[model samples]
Target: MTEPSVPHAPTAAFIGASWLALVAGAATYLIGLFNAEMALNEKGYYLTLLMYGLFSAVSLQKSVRDRAESISVSGLYFGLCWLSLLLALLLLLIGLWNANLALSEKGFYGMAYLLSLFSSVAVQKNVRDVSLVRQAAPAK
Candidate 1:
């Protein structure tokens, strides 16, 4: 089988920045949760949504990458990946809508959550692209 035509590897600065964004967004969100005065259940719900969002974002990115490379991703699995990502977003929105936090606080959580998700997707793409390029390189 022919190897896929992988694109150029991600730059060090880009990769570093991707990692930094992910860590910063996630850390800030978690730290906020830790210091919030909300009930334990509410905190747990937000934390779970954050985890779920990150995972689903990564999963969706990988599936998209695989499809781009002409790998055989099942229709059902692909659909599920998209569905999970949407569900995570919907859950976050609904939770925030009914939350007792201030508008600014809700905005803060929303922006940080989105930033974390976007960075995770970028990081996953960078990882897969870099790995593919390295695999295609000739090792002496």
Candidate 2:
């Protein structure tokens, strides 16, 4: 009996982007949990949002994917993700500042601000899978 051939699968950029977003979201949430009192305020929330935006815009949008998907849709997804994070960060900052948090604490939040951004870019854009590459016959 002959073995069946395997079919190729199209890479979905959404999965990669989503994974990055998830990691960033998880990390920020964990960090906040670890330092609840320290993170108790608007600055912490702002930091989270900033990280989100960074992931969405700097990371997701920057990924150069050659998937079987339209560029326009990808761009829209990237834009919306980044915009939402930016708005959230702005609101958090405003709230924290209004609450009169210390400057040093605010600055500390900036440290983890790029975690999402980095993850967004770090996520693999192209997933590897088996493909049938034709090979030339050796000279007889």
Candidate 3:
């Protein structure tokens, strides 16, 4: 019989980089929003999109990981996780496409938003890996 594979903890550098990317992306996006010349409602829209994108990305990552590990994530929930992440991306694209900002500003927001989403997934994976490693370790 094949033995189940053990979870390995992420390296310190990777963990640190993941967290740094998440923080830098999110902070840059939020700071841009704070300084933008847009109306309050417009700012709120971008803020909401960033928050939604982050949550959906993390949720999708967890769902995918659970399924890979043979954990019982329901089909419906899994589908929704995918759908939510896609919807977040779609909404951001639509928002940016129709906004009145200069091309450079639009590019800036798009890059920061994508960076934040990607880093969130990496951070979530690192967190889960660390947790699994800790759980699998024998008690001292």
Candidate 4:
């Protein structure tokens, strides 16, 4: 019989880049928020959106990976993960569309928000891959 395949660990460069992207995206978004001359409530809304988006993205990624590995994931939970991520995106878009910000500001927030969400998923995947590779390694 053929041996089971081993999951390869992600390269150090990839891991570092994923982390850097996550940090840069998050930091840039937060800094923009801090510098924006908006009302406190508006800033809170954007902050909450960023947090929600990141959490949902990471959760969805984990759920998808688990399903791919034949792990038992409840259909309801998986569906919610997808719904939450979509909702977060929708809310951000609607908020931006209605906000009293300039076009460049809106674009900045949108780009940073997307970057953060994407990078968070990448970071989560790298972490999971590294864990799997370590677990598959035999003790010396």
Candidate 5:
């Protein structure tokens, strides 16, 4: 029989970096939005998208992990998780594409948005992995 896996803690550097990247990306995006020449309504739209993207990304990551581990994940929920992630991305792309901002501003927003999404996923995965590892460990 295969030996049981041990619960290993995440490296301090990885955890710290993941958190830092997430914060930096999100902060940069928001700061850009706050200083943007767009109307308040436009700012609201982008802010909502960011919130939705972060939530959906994390949910998708968790659902994916659950499926990978053979845990029971409902098909509808799983499908919704995927749909939300895609929709969020599509919405961001469309918004950025149609905005009147200069190419540089557009590029900056796009990069920040993508960085935030990617870092959020990484953060979610790291948290989940650490949780599972701890749960598997015997009480000392």
Candidate 6:
């Protein structure tokens, strides 16, 4: 017989989510800032978002496989991440092509950064939850 596994409390979950968000947000911000010159061209923004979407999809799949459990929260997170990235890319393109949109893009980018941060944290939490559930389940 196997011992039961412990799950994190809601408070712990909130703290963990916040920390993950902060770390991921900072990392993404730095990556974008450092690579702006090389990576922020009209087409590059779309390409970058596309790449992120693809990578996230793969990661989500791997997480599901590792957990051996279906978690709708994971799917929700990936969808949000892709949506946020697409919005950011669209705003970036508009900024490049239109002056008015350029001003909005600045603000949009900031919000997008926040969204990315939150989404990262959410995904992390969901993955952890799924893993815990899988571990706690009795052997078949």
Q: Residue-wise lDDT of candidate 6 within 17-123, one digit each (tens)?
A: 75676566656555645545443564355446534643454455445544454434466676665666566556544644553344555564465555564565466
Model 4 pairs whose backbones collide: none
Model 5: colliding residue pairs: none
Per-residue lDDT tens digits for candidate 3, residues 40-111, read 999999999999999999999999988777778899999999999999999999999999999999999999
Model 1, span 1-140: residue lDDT tens: 34569789999999999999999999989999999889999999999999999999999989887887788889999999999999999999999999999999999999999999999999998998888888889997
lDDT (Cα, 0-100) at 11 in candidate 1: 95
Q: Write down the TM-score of every candidate.
A: 0.96, 0.42, 0.95, 0.95, 0.92, 0.35
Supply the global lDDT for candidate 3: 0.93
What C-alpha RMSD separates each model from the true structure?
1.1, 10.3, 1.9, 2.3, 2.5, 10.8
For 1-140, candidate 4 gives per-residue lDDT tens digits of 34335678999999999999999999999999999999999999999999999999999999997777777789999999999999999999999999999999999999999999999999999998888788888988
| Residue 100, candidate 1: C-alpha displacement in angstroms | 0.4
Q: Identify the runs in model 4 with alpha carbons over 4 angstroms from their true place.
A: 1-5
Candidate 2's residue-wise lDDT over 27-135, tens digit each? Answer: 7645654665654554355555655565554444443332223333366666666676677567556655765447765554443454554454444332322222112
- CA deviation > 4 Å runs, candidate 5: 1-7
CA-lDDT, candidates in order: 0.93, 0.50, 0.93, 0.93, 0.90, 0.54
RMSD of 1: 1.1
Candidate 5 lDDT for residue 31: 100
Judged by TM-score relative to the true structure, which candidate is superior, 2 or 5? 5
**Residue 70 alpha-carbon offset, candidate 2, angstroms:** 5.4
Candidate 5 per-residue lDDT, tens place, 41-134, comes to 9999999999999999999998887776667789999999999999999999999999999999999998999899999998987887798788
TM-score ranking from best candidate downward = 1, 3, 4, 5, 2, 6
Off by over 4 Å in 6: 1-5, 9-40, 46-101
